[model samples]
Target chain A: MLISSAQGAVRAADTLITANWLDYLLIAIYFAFVLGIGFMARRQVSDSIDFFLSGRSLPAWVTGLAFISANLGAVEIMGMSATGAQMGLPTVHYFWVGAIPAMLFLGVVMMPFYYGSKVRSVPEFMLRRFGPGAHLVNSLSFALAQLLIAGVNLYLLASIVHALLGWPMWTALIVAAVIVLSYITLGGLSAAIYNEVLQFFVIVASLLPLTLIGLHRVGGYGGLKDKITAAAANNDKITPAKDQLESWPGLPLSGFDSPLLSVIGIVFGLGFVLSFGYWTTNFVEVQRAMASNSISAARKTPIIGAFPKMFVPFIVILPGMVAAVLVNEIVQLKASGGEAAIPGGASGDVKYNDALLLLMRDVLPNGLLGLAIAGLLAAFMAGMAANISAFNTVFSYDLWQTYVQKDKPDHYYLGIGRLATFAATVVAIFTATIAGKFGNIMDYLQTLFGFFNAPLFATFILGMFWKRMTATAGWMGLVAGTLSAIAVWSAGEFGKAFELSGQGLAFVAASTAFVVDIVVSVVVSLMTAPKPEGSLKGLVYSETPKEDLIDPHEASLPFFQRTVPLALIALAMVLVLNVIF
Target chain B: MSHTPERYDAEDARDDVREDVADAGTDTGSGRHTAGAFDIRNIIGALLSIYGLILTLASFVGDQSLDKTGGVRANLWTGLALLAAGLAFMAWAKAKPIVVPDHIPHDDDRPAGH
Candidate 1:
C-alpha cells in the first residue's frame, strides 16, 4: 500500500503544481525562521520544567494560538477540506458542535484542576488523583498514541514534500523527520509552542486567499448554492440539496438512515463524548493550556482559541465546497460515486483529498502557491512537534522518572527528554509507513481516539469529581472501557453488526466506551477502598478550596478579560453561526 | 496544605511579588525587558515581514498569471495584506511586551510516588 501510494504520488506530482525559484525561496525562508526560532528558544531551557512545560511562564495569547495550531495538522486541513467537499456545510458540526463546547469546558472547568495541581503532563495528574496503576496505564497508552498519530502527521508531511519537490518517499520522510526533530530537540516545548503560533498565522495567510479566490470563481455564495442544488438534482447518491446546505440533523455525515438517530448520534456520540474526550483530556492540547503563566491564563487559553476555531470553517470548508462546484475533477468524482480515474496521472482515482490541491492548482498563481505550500509545511511540523514534545514529557517525567530512575537529578530527566524526542521522531518515520496502509486516514484517527482518549476522559472526569473512586477502579475502568471500544469497533468492522461504517461506527464505539467506563468506575468504586480525604486536596473538586481553582487577581479585571464571559461570548457566537448556516 | 508543601517556599513568595510588578508594568503601557531577546512576537513579525516583502516583490516581477485567478492580482493583494499584518504585530509587541519574571515558579515539587 505504501509503495503504490508513493508511486502514485510521484506520478501526480508534476501535474499538481509546477514551482519556480520564487516558490523555492519562500519555502527556504520559512525553513530558516523555523530553525532560527528553535535556536533562540534553546537558550531559555535551563531546567526540566523549561524543557517540558515552558516553565509555565508563557502568556495566554501565545499558548492559545499554539493550542489551536498544534491541532491544525496537514491531516486535519486536508481531511476537513475533503469532508467539506463530500458532506457540504454539515462539516461545520466538527467545529461548532464537536469542538467549541469541549474546548470551552476545558478552559472553564478542567484547566483549574490541571494547572492548580501543577502537573507537567496529563498522566502525572492521573497519578496524583488515582495512583500508580492508572498513571502507568495512561502514560504508556498516551506515549503509544502520540507516536502513532505523530506518524500520521509525518506521513502526510513527507507526502507533501514529495509532491512539491518530487523527492523520493524515503528521502522526503527523512528530511521532514530531521527538520521537526531538530527544532523539538533544540528548544523543547518552547520551540514547539512558538512555532505553532507562527504556523497559525501562515496557515491563515495561505488558506484565506485560496478560500476568497475560490469563492470569487464560483460567483459568490449564491452561485455556489445554485450550482450545488443543480448538481444534487443530477446525482442520486448524494444527500438532497437542502440537507447538504444545512448544518442540523446531518443525515449523510452521520451515516444514519433515520433523522432522529442521526441527531442523537451526533449530539451524544460526537458532540459530547468524542469531542470532550479529545479536546479536554488529550495531552497534546491540554499541554498548551498547562504552559500558561497563571491560573487565569491557563483557564483562558482554550477559550481564546475557541474564538479563532469557530471561524476556521469559513476558510477551510468553504474552499472545499467551492471546489466541489468549480473543479471538474471533483465534480466528476462525486458524480461517479467518489472514485474516477484521472485523465493522465498514474493515480487511479481522484479522491476528495485532492479537492484543495486541485483548487490551488486551478486558482492560485506562482507566489501565492508557494505561500500555500509553506502553510502546509508549517501545519505538518506543528502537529508532529506537538506529538513529540508531549511524548518526551510523558516518557521522561511520567514513565522514566516515576518508574526507572526515581531519584535522578532534574537535568538527567531533561537529557532523557531530549533523547526521547530524537527517538520518537525516528520511530514516527517507521510508523508513517504503517499509516499509509489505510485508505481513509480519518477513520483510523477516530478509532484510535476511541481506544485511548474516550476511556481516559471517563477515568479522569469520574476520579476528579467523585473522591470515592479508588485507584483500582481508575485503571480497571480504563482497561475495560478501552477493551469495550475495541470490541465494538471489531464487531462493526468484521461482523457488520452495527450497520454503520466510517465516522458513525467510530462515534458509536466511543459512546459505548464512555458509558461503559463510567458505569464500571461507579460499580468498582463502591467495592474498593478509597484514598484518604486528606490526600485528595487539590486533586478532587469537592476537597479543593475555591481559591486554588480560580485566580484571585481576575476579580479586578474587566468582564471581557474574564474566563467565563469570554467563553459565554464564544458559545453565543458559535450558536449564531449554527443558526445562520 | 499537606498535598503541596512547595507552594510555601520563600522563592515563590518573592516571585509572586515580581510577577505582580511585571503585570502592572505591562498594564500601564510601560515597556519592560521581559523575554526581550526571545520574544515570540518579534520573531513572528520578522518572518511575516520577510515573506510579505518577498511576495510583494514577486507580484511585480514574477509571473502575474491573470488567467488562473479570473483576472485578479492575488499576489499583490495578499502581499500588501501580509505586510500590514506583519507591521501591526511588530507594533503590538513594541507597545505591550510580555513580562517574564527571572524565576517563574514551578509548583510541582512533590516526590514521585510509586
Candidate 2:
C-alpha cells in the first residue's frame, strides 16, 4: 500500500489497518447490526409520532447517549483532531467553553420551552411564539442546511473510504447511505437513536486503543509533550519556538493563545452566543431531548450527555498530539540530505484531517487497526443517520404537514416522512458523487452558520425572557439581525480581498449580529404592541408559573442531584485537563 | 361599546376526554392493549442481536492477511456471544410485552401538552 512518487519518497496509500479478513468481517457484522436495528423497529412506527419523536417515550439514558452521539459527528472528528494538531490544546475550549456550559443552559433552562411547548419541531415553536415569517425563515434555512450538511458528510465519508480501501467513491457513498436508510425507514427515530448509541460505543472502543498505545510509546503525556516540542522546535522549514508547542499562551493572553484567536472571541462569540444558538435553538440537537418520555427526563438529557462529551477530546485530540511528533520526525528525515519532501503526503507535512489515520499507520498492528477503522466508519454513518432523522422530522412537521396538506391521517404523514427520508438520502448521495464541482460550498456553508444561528439566538433570548416581545418584533428582529450578519460577513470578505487585517472575522460576525439582534428586538418590542398577558399564558415566562418551567420533583431534590452535579463534574474535568496540558 | 374574549380551555378539555376514551377503546382486535407505540425491549433487543450476529458471522468468514487481523478470532468469538445475548433479549421481550394498563397512574394530573 506504499505510494512512491517519482521523487522516491514513499507515502502510505492505505491509511491504516492493512485490510485483511477480520477487518472486513468486523465491518460487515456492524453493518448487519445497523440494518437489524432498523428492520426490527419497523412495526412500532405506527404513526408519525413514532417516526419522528419515538412517540416521546424514550428514557433519559437512551436519549442522553443519542444526544451526545448526534453532536459527536464523524465528520467533525477529523476536524477536531486537526485543530488539536494545528492550534494546540486551546481547541478543547470548543468543547468546554463552547459546548458544556451551553448544553447545561439548554437542559436546565431551555428544555422547558421545547418539551413543555409540545411543539413537534423548533419551527413550530417559532410559529407559536413569533409568527409565520420567523417560522418559515428558520424552517427553510435549517432544511436546506441539513441537506447540504448530509451531502457534504456523504462526500467526506466516500472520499476517506476511497483513499483507504481504494473503493470507488460511489461504492462508499451508496453502501453507507443504504445502511443508514434501511434502519431509518424501518424503525424511524428510535432505530436511529439506538444505532447512534451503538455507534458511539463502537467508535469509542475502537479508537481508545490508538490513544493508549500512542501515549505508551511516547512514554507518557509528559513524555509526549517533551518529544513533540523538541521535534517541532528543530524542524528547519518552520521555526517553532518552544512556545509554539504550548497549550497556554505564555505571552500576553496567558490563559489562551492570543496570536491564534482571543479567549474573549472563544468564550463570548463561540461559548455564549453561537454555542447557545446551536445547542438551544437548533432542533437537530434538541430533537434528542424532545424525545424523552417526561419533562423530568427531557431536562436530564443534555446533562447526562455532557459527562461523556467532556471526555471525547482524550481519544480524538491526543492522537493529533502524537501525530505532531511523528509529523515533525517525518519532515526532518525527508529534509535531512537535501531530499525532496512529498508536500502534503506522509514524508512532507502532517495532514490535519488525516491525523488519526497517520497515527494508525505509525503504530497499531492489524487487529486493532481494523477495529479503529470500523469505529470511524460507524461514527460517520451515525452522524449521517442523525442528520437524516432530524431532516425528515423538520421537513414533515414544519413544511409538508403545515403548508402542503393539513389535518391528514396519522399514517398519511408517516408515509410522507419515510418518502422524505428516501428522497433526502438519494439527494445526499448524488451530491456526494458530484461534490468536486462545488467544492467550496463547505466554506460558504461554514460562514453561513453564523449568519443563520447567531441572529436567531438573539430573537429566541428576547422571546423567551421578555414578555413584551411582540410577534411583529420577533419577525423584524430576526430579519434585521440576519441582514446585519450578512453585511458583516461581506465586509470581512471585502477587507480580506483588500489585504486588510480581517483577523477573527467569524467572531466579529457573530458578536455584531447578536448585538444588533438584541438592540432591534428590544426597541421593536417597546415600540410595538405586546401580546396580552392572558393570550401569552404558557409561552412566556411572566405568564407561565415557576413550576412548569422547573420540575417540582427535580427542584425538590438535593443540590447533588443529577442535573447540576453532572455539569459540575464536566466543568471540573475540563479544568483538570486544561491545567494538566 | 364592549368587547368579549374566548379561550380554548373547554375545547381542549373535551379533546382530552375524547382522546382518553379513544385510547381506552383502542383494543380493536379482541381483548387487550399492548405497548403504546414504543416497544423499548423489542427495539433495543433487535439492535443488540443484530450487532451480535454480524460480529459472529464476520469471525467465521473474515479475511486473514499481513497488516490485518493477525488471525485473531476475537471478532468471531465476540460476535457469537453477542448473537446469543441478543436472542435472550428478544426472548425476554416476547415473554413480557409490556401490557400498558388502561388507566395509567397520575394521567389526569399532568398538563396535556404544549
True contacts kept of each: 0.50, 0.03
- Each prediction's TM-score versus the true structure: 0.93, 0.80
Q: After superposition, how far is residue A286 of candidate 2 from its true place, in Å?
A: 0.3
In CAPRI terms, where does candidate 1 land? acceptable
* Backbone collisions counted per model: 0, 6
Per residue, candidate 2 scores C-alpha lDDT tens digits across A384-465 of 8888899999899889887898777778888889999999999889766554344233234445567788888888877888
By DockQ, the best candidate is 1
Give the candidate number with the greatest lDDT. 1
Interface RMSD of 2: 10.4
What is the DockQ of the complex in model 1? 0.30
